[model samples]
Target: MRKALILSSVLLPAITAAGIAAAGSEEKPDVQTIVSKANLVAYYQGNDGKAKVNMVITDKSGNKRQREFIILRKDVKDGGDQNYFVYFHQPADVRRMTYMVNKHAQLDKDDDRWLYMPALDLVKRIAAGDKRTSFVGSDFLYEDVSGRSLEEDTHELTETTDQLYIVKNVPKKPDTVEFNYFTVAIDRKTFVPMKMEFFDKQDKLYRVIESKKVEKIQDFYTVVKSEVRDLKKESKTEMEFGNVQYNINLGDDLFTERYLRRPPREAIR
Candidate 1:
């Protein structure tokens, strides 16, 4: 369940599921060789962590924009219900946020999500239909942001380059996903994901994720620098993290619906 557990997507359609196992075929390809590319998957582990993100958006025609956020993670149990907190913050403005609190006893399915809006002072539930859409208007899908079974994606090993497998991702389900498909580079020796390129519904490369730094924490080595590149545009998303601690105590009070609607707000000076 350690490595394999990360490969399944509970609600994702078979074709676009995030973490499915690759089929075994002699002439076809070896997906396992490709799925482990670039040591990207290895960074997903840990119970507590945080990252400061810089997102840049650029169009294929060479236009760009930049934004920032702080991502915090911790596991907590409230009133006998166990859950994890994935929090985001933009220090300068309260008007902008993609903040959500996800409560799940199970990994893939059975999760409750709440988002706080500064404009309405309301915490609303994200519609199920909208979960597949991109979060914060970024290239990464919402499913990729919140949580999905990592092993549900199926892979096709294209070839080995730089001692890693160039894998093409084929969703198990045909039309259930937002993005087209993924082409990731998996490390040959370490089973890590090095680079991930995503295509659109038209099967054109639009986004690419590249790993920058690797660190060991809580028995799992995590990606310290992750850059999400938008090929169609002139911008990218850079996620950087340090002091990557895991399994630290996160108070249950922080994961409640009340907190989601009205998290601590600094007093206006």
Candidate 2:
């Protein structure tokens, strides 16, 4: 979700410095601070970035489908508002389809999302209720493409181990989401969320998002591969990132509705 990989050009050094400063410190950061840092590390990387992603969707019967897309993201402010543009590039049927999001940080404001279906020649506004629905028939939800706001959940530091800080998050408005609650296991050193487990109303674990691989790019620790599994359905989506670059100075104009229909050259390339 949200690229599934964390690649930072501008913020890595700061994170490293903070990590060095906290070395051997017995007192751990509060739950809010830990969650905030994890959020920033996961979603708010460089000022702007780009990644080419290949998604493999597999059903319970073991049939598989693949989709290829390029994602472009620009941060309005670190740990605040952001913009996302995704252009599908493969599998003929979905080629040229695009999705855009104007993500607002305010708790009272909802993110604006749009989907462009080239075959139908329609640009449709995605309803807030649909954010949790399957994304392009994949296990990942639409909300996974951008991110869910930290303010929407109340967090508690449930456990701390030598390597991770475990936090349990409960939705502030339970009715708005499908999961009863979720717990995130964040790496202590990098603050990257290593795994997230989502439990259903019956308190049974039904979904899981986990980081599969991490790499250092441009001196930044980044997650390069991940998977989302629907345990109940025995289906899963595996995503791999390639050709990722950060701080590319992407312009705001590239994310506008105009480009959704006629994708910019940068997006297609």
Candidate 3:
């Protein structure tokens, strides 16, 4: 009998069990290798983590709406399955709202998401479609919240600079994606995508996301501040993360539907 090799659903496109080779080393990696590493580095930090996020959504007319939430994330395995629980605290009307996600690394499967509204006292499952749709009326999309699967895009290493690796990514299914292609500039040292630009089929830049600041939190390099701009709409959203702590003990129970209606006080804090 032969044993089959189990592959990590996340990085199978490029990275292997050994890991990405260090930059400037003898073994330089390809675009897939760079993207695979960047995807993990950007999303999967410690086994589990928690953060308080403050978002300010500004419209073209200069109207601003504020939202505050506490995010709890747990990794079932690095570059594999993960779970997220978000509890909204600010903006009196939307207070006590909660969102939960069960993300699978499999590119073919859609992540499971659910939302809870305290005012209505209702929990509804979010249908997966057009992931480009605004999340909570913000410029950030649903895909941005869970993560964009590495396998959904084909990567090309266009250039390499002293501090960044520029890669162009084209979606596998053209009709399924809103943009014709997008480019990401990954920091060579930190493996974080410092900036990204999205272009429509006409090759017009429609959206941009940038990391404004990053700091080392508990030895892990983290993006503490970022912004997303909708060029067509002339709108922007600023996201700032605080009180970040990694490897927190977020139990599996927190990611369940039961918690959607009845959020765990401990997990939110």
Candidate 4:
């Protein structure tokens, strides 16, 4: 199944399960306005940012594998175009692997991505195909790491609570996406999506992502911990972010293919 980016935790509580149907009489903002605010809150915190990531992938048997990396991001425009550099640091076998992505906000445009492997000493340009493919063998997808464009889907304000706004999203090109529709619960005050559910064409809930924790860093409400659970596979991926800094001075050269093959020591360190 295709995954949503800037997403949530793997397994949520029973409260949220029932809360999906809950509604309130509180006055609410328009769907477009709420979605625009959520997009900015989730992805456009600053012109540039840096973070250390720790990802734990668990299979149905409960076996766990860990991977660590550092990500550097720079936005050419507040919410239009962005550049990302991801450097893998852990897992002795995959150490020094790097990836670069150029994400465009326009739905008509496709993102550019490249991957480099130290072991093979080869740089491969990742072709655009299935954004739903597992990211480095984890439950997360390529779109999850880079992000999905807001314009790709149409949004509707389905329900509202005192603290949250439940929004339903239907992809503009339904045939290109695996999900029939998805629901996101956006925090009223912070505009962060606290929970998301993806439904298949059959209307069965097969995947859920939720934010478990959020903390303010550099005055930005950030999701520090989150997870993605595959209900059918009975597997999940838990991810944590640390050492997050916003508005850092990241030069444009850092997002080049040269950096993907020969990563800058300073940025990764």
C-alpha lDDT score of every prediction, in listed order: 0.55, 0.85, 0.84, 0.83
Compared with the true structure, what per-residue lDDT tens digits does model 1 show for residues 1-269? 43332242222235333234453332322465234322234433444555555655554555554556655555442111234444444435644444555534343555566667767777778654545666566665555555433344676776777667787777776476656778777665555667878788998887777877766656666767777776766566666665556555445566666656555442110
Q: Write the per-residue lDDT of candidate 4 for residues 17-81, one digit (tens) a residue.
A: 54555753333456866776677677778789989999999999999999999999998765578
User: Which candidate wins on TM-score?
Assistant: 3
10 residues in a row with least lDDT, candidate 3: 1-10
Residues 207-255, model 2: lDDT tens digits: 9999999887765667889999999999999999898888899988888
CA lDDT, candidate 1, residue 88: 47
RMSD in Å for model 3: 4.1
Best by lDDT: 2
Error of 1 at 220 (Å): 3.4
For model 4, state the Cα shift of residue 93 in Å.
2.0
| lDDT at residue 237 of model 2 (Cα atoms) | 99
For model 4, the stretches where C-alpha displacement exceeds 4 angstroms are 1-27
Sequence-dependent TM-score of model 2? 0.87
Better of 1 and 4 by TM-score: 4
